[model samples]
Target: MDNLQKCPQIVDILPTAEGQVRPMTKLEPQEQHEVWLRAVELAGGKVPTGRIVKDVVQKIMERTKVPNTYQIGEVCQILVKDNPELRGKGGCWGIVSAVNEFSCTLRMWDGEYTIGLQHLKSYNYLPAECEQMQVICDACGGLRLRINRVYSSGLEESVQKFLESLGKLNRASLTALEEKLLKVLESEIRD
Candidate 1:
């Protein structure tokens, strides 16, 4: 009798004192109904024999769009206004020297300028902002001047040495020397 319970239908069967079998008593209705459904599914249409099907759908949809293009000269104009390094510096405009799908190079007055795809939106030219400014030596009392441009790193060390030598001179002589140096710088820039 215990061994018979291992069989699906036998577990659903009942026994009498003579050991005769009959249908089992109606069990929990809901549980029995679920079991019957699952058993039928297992038998393929009466029971689901193949793998269960699940929906594989994406939650997000991304935008796939391209950007617009501008003329070569138009891009150069924009860089002159927006890029700080190029602003107010005359002769820094030109046509787009080269361009690819993603970026373009502008032939600027200073050098070749490379810009990105997104940055192209702001490209346009403005009138030259200001005249070139000159740097006058404070010590020379307006005698020497140079272009207000970046100097090599080593040049700064030389300037510091010159300042130290000025410190060692007599007050009157140092003043004259400073003026002379300023005049020399002014001449160089003027040349």
Candidate 2:
């Protein structure tokens, strides 16, 4: 005997559409993933064929949407939750240079790096923190600053190793080093 709750009729649950899926170019990767999971659940957990999954996901993508949460000019931290490649690169700050469908390009002191949407989180910076970054950028020829990316640079290589901790700090938990580093950098720029 089939369980009524477990095997509910998919037809009744799913809206009847005109058999078309709109462009998914606008759907965020996370949204597309959710749509794919819903499609599988709709198929009774048998893992429907790839073609069916894709079609259903596309169809759902037409109805559902998720907006980009990260914005340009906002500071963001690289999260290594799922991407092992970023294992030791957490707590680093970067300026958002560009935003794409499922990723963003961040300009760092050395260069620009692109990270997928899943590997990013917003960094809450204090007013002073922002101005400090701008100061570093201005002094460095508007180039990216490496103060927060200490993970990439050995502590011994840091002009002031203490600055590396700033990246790990949030607006509410800023450290004195954050301010000191800005002051030091600004002074060095004057010379």
Best by TM-score: 2
TM-score of 1: 0.26
Compose the digit string of candidate 2's lDDT tens values, residues 2-100.
333565553244323322122223367766445545665766654445446555654664354435667677777787653466654676767677998
lDDT of 1 by residue, 59-148 (tens): 000012233364444434433322354434322333465765556675432245566443344334442211111011123322211222
Question: What are the TM-scores, per candidate, against the unseen true structure?
Answer: 0.26, 0.42
Give the poorly placed runs of model 1, Cα more than 4 Å off. 1-65, 75-94, 121-191
After TM-score superposition, the amount by which residue 66's alpha carbon in candidate 2 deviates from its true location, in angstroms, is 2.1
lDDT of each: 0.35, 0.56
* Candidate topping lDDT: 2
TM-score quality measure for candidate 2: 0.42
List candidate 2 stretches off by more than 4 Å.
Answer: 1-65, 126-131, 140-191
Clashing pairs in 2: 109-144
